[model samples]
Target: MRTIVQQGTRCTALAGYVRPDTLDSALAARAKGLRVAAGCTDLFAAVRGPALSGGILDITAIPELRAISETPEHWRLGATATWSDIRLAPLPPAFDGLKAAARELGAAQVQNAGTLGGNLVNASPAADGAPCLLTLEAEVELASRRGTRRLALGDFLTGPRQTALAEDELLTAVLVPKSAAAGHGAFLKLGARRFLVISIAMAAARLDLDGGRVRHAALAVGACSATARRLPAAEAALAGARADAGLAAAITADLVVPGLSPIDDLRASADYRAAAAVTLLRRAVAGLCTGREAAA
Candidate 1:
C-alpha cells in the first residue's frame, strides 16, 4: 500500500495510484473520483492507449474487501475476493454453481486475479458470475461516505455495461441469504472450443428436494439476454416436480425461451443460444438429481 497524502480528509496515492488499506481511506480516494479497481484483469485488457487513462483506487489492499465470511443469516463474499478464492473456499454444495463458474471464469492466471467485484462491475452480459449469483439470490452491498446500502443482484445490473452503483459508492460485498442457500447448484456454458473461450450460452440452476420431489428451483441464463436474468416462470414449472431424468427432460427449449432475449451474434445464432440454454439448464437439473456433476 502506498502512503496517502491527505488533503483536508481527501486522499491520493503515489502519482494518484491510490491503494488504500482502510475503507475510510478508500472511500476518501473514491470521493475524489479515482477509478476504483480490484484485480484489474479487465482494466489492463481494455486499455488500448499507450498508457492508462487515470489513477485508480486499488481496493485489493483493503483486508476487509478480500474476505469470504459466513454469518448465521447469510454468506458474505467480499468485493475483491478472486475467483480462485471462491473455488477454493469450503462452501456448501449450494454454491456449486458459483464454484463451477469460478473454475471456468478464465485461465488459471485470470482466475487468480479476476475478482467478483470486477466481474459484476464490468456488467458484461455474458459474465459467468451473474447467472450463478442470480440463481443464489445474491445481493450486493454498496458503500459510500454518506452511508451503506444493498440492492438485489438482479436490480444491480441495469443493462449491458451498466449497473446501479452510484459514482461515489463502492461495491463492498455480495450477500447470499440463508433462505436461498438451501439447495445444490450447478453452472454450465457452451463455447466454440471450451477452455478460455467467451460464452455463447450459459446457465445456472439450483434445486432443493423434499421427499424425492423438488421443493425449490431457480434457473438463470446469461449470454442470452441484455443482462443475465432469472426465469421465475420456468422455476414455477419446476417446483413440486419429481426429481428424476423425466423431470429434467421436461426442461425443453421453449421452457426458458420466453425468459431470454438472445440476439444473433458472431459467436452463435440467437435461436442456437436459446436452445443451448435449455439443454444446459436441463443437464444441470439432471446432474443434481442423479448425483453427478452438472457441468459435464
Candidate 2:
C-alpha cells in the first residue's frame, strides 16, 4: 500500500493507492477502507473537486475479474468487463438490448473505459445499462473475505445512488440466467437530443414468441423512479397476445403508469417522463416484434 496526498486548493485528502493483481488482495484492500476503482470513469470525475480521501483499490489488473464466460445455465460478465467489451461480445439475442444500451453510454472514450460493475455500483436512476439489465433479470455477485453472495439486480439496487453492496464486499460479476437469455430484445431511449445525452426515459423489452404469440415478456423502464422497475402488469397483459403490432395495443398507459414514480427534473417534467416511459415501452416491445418478423 502506497500513501498519496491529493493536493487541492481548499483541502487535501490523503489517499492510498493499491494495485492488487489477485481477488484476495483486492478484497483485503477493500476491507481496509480503500475505495474500489476499475475503469475510474466515474471515480475520477467524482473526486475532481474533493481530493480522494481513502486510497484506491485498483482491481483492473486482476485477470479473474476481467474475464467474461458462460456456463450451461448462465452468462457471467466479469466486474472489469468494459462497455465496449460487452457491446462486442458474442452474446445471444436477449443481450441485444444491453448491447444497444452499451453503444449509447456516453461516447467511445467512456465506453472503452467504463465497466459494467462500475455502472451498476454507481446506481444512477438514469443509468443507460440498468433498464436493460433489469429486463434481462440479471443477478449481481458480491464477494468478500468472508464468502460470496448473489442478489437479484432489483434487490441489489436499493435507490438512487444506493446499492446493497457492503463496505468490505466487491462486486465480482453479473449473471444472466439462461432462461432470460432466450428471447429477442430491444431498447428504446428518449432524450432531449440525439447523441451523448442522458435519457429522459428509456425502456428495454424482451419477448419470447411461440406460434406467433407471446409466450414470455420482460419489460423495464428507467429514469422514471428511484430505481428502474419491471412492468409486471404490462408483461402479464402481453402473454398470449399476438407477437406483432397488436402486441403494442396490449401495453396501455394504465398498466405502466402505476409502476412509475417520476419526478420533475430540469430535463423533463414528471408527467412528460411518465408519458415518455409508456411510449418507450410500447416502442421497445414493438421493435422486438418487428425484428422477429424480419428474421422470419
Candidate 3:
C-alpha cells in the first residue's frame, strides 16, 4: 500500500487509495483491513477531522455492485445504487415510502452521491430510509472473501451507529421480497422545519386492502428507538380495520407507546417525540387509505 500526505489540511499521514474494478478485488482489499468507500458522502465527512491512517478501498467502479434489478422472487438493490436511482426506478406502490424517503434524504447533490447501502451501514437511529425499509420487510446481503450471508434489516441494525456487519464483510445488496410489494405505502416525517432537517419522529406504513378492509398492515417508526422498529401491536390492531379516513382513530397513541424508547435530544424531548410518532403513524395510515401524500 502507498502512503499519502495532505499538505495544507489538518488531515495528515493519509494512506493509500485503491479503486478496484471487480468485487473480488474489493473484498480482498477489505479482508486486509482497508476502509471501504462507495459514494464517500458520509466517509469524507466522518474522516475530515483526523487523517485516514489506513488503506482505502473504493468499490464504486464494481459493475455488479451498482445495478438495481428485480427477480421473480425479489427486488435486488445493489450497494452502490444512489438515492437518485431509487427515486427514478419503476418500482411498485409498496416502495412509494422508500422513494419518498429517497427524495427527502438531502439536497440534489447528496441524492446523486449518497447510496442506500451506505445509509444502512451507517445505522443512524434517525436515518430517513430505515423506517420505510422496515415496513417493506427489507433484507441485507453481506459478502466477504469466505462467502455470503443475508439478514433481516431489523436484525442487522444493532443500535445507534452499529450494525451486524463483520469487519471483512461488505454490504452488497438490499433485498425486498415480492410478497411485500403489493401494498400501498406512505411516509410521514416530523421536523422542526421543512427540508434539510433531521427528523424528530418519522413513520412509514404499508397496507394491503381487500374489499375496503385491511388484509395486511406494516407500521414502523424511527428516531424513537435504538433502531427503527415495527409496531407489531399497532399493525395487529389495523389488520382488519376499514380502509377509510376513520382508520386513523383506531391507531391510538397507546398502541404505539410500547414500541418506542425515545431519548431527549437537542432536536426534541422524549415526550414530544413519542407524541409526534403517534401522530405521524395516524397520518401515514390515513394517507395510504385515501391515496394522498403524507410526508411534508
Model 1 root mean square deviation, Cα atoms: 5.4
Give TM per candidate: 0.92, 0.93, 0.92
Candidate lDDT values, in order:
0.86, 0.86, 0.85
Better of 2 and 3 by lDDT: 2
Off by over 4 Å in 2: 1-15, 49-51
State the lDDT of candidate 1 residue by residue for 1-296, as single tens digits. 22111111233368758887789988987888878788888887775454555577888877778788888788888898899989988787889999999999889999988999999999999999999999899999999999999999999999989999999889999999989998799999999877798899999999988887889999999999999999988888889988877788777766689879787889989988888999899888888988833432
Clashes of each: 0, 1, 0
Instruction: Spell out the clash pairs found in candidate 1.
Output: none
For model 1, state the Cα shift of residue 267 in Å. Answer: 1.0
| Cα deviation of 175, candidate 3, in Å | 0.5
lDDT for 252 (candidate 2)? 89
Which tens-of-lDDT digit does each residue in 1-296 have in candidate 2?
11111111121223477786778888988999888887898889877543666677877777767677888788888888888888988888999999999988888999988989999999889988889998889999999999999999999999999999999999998998989998888888999777688889999999988899999999999988889999999999999889987789888889998898887889999999989998888888888888889989
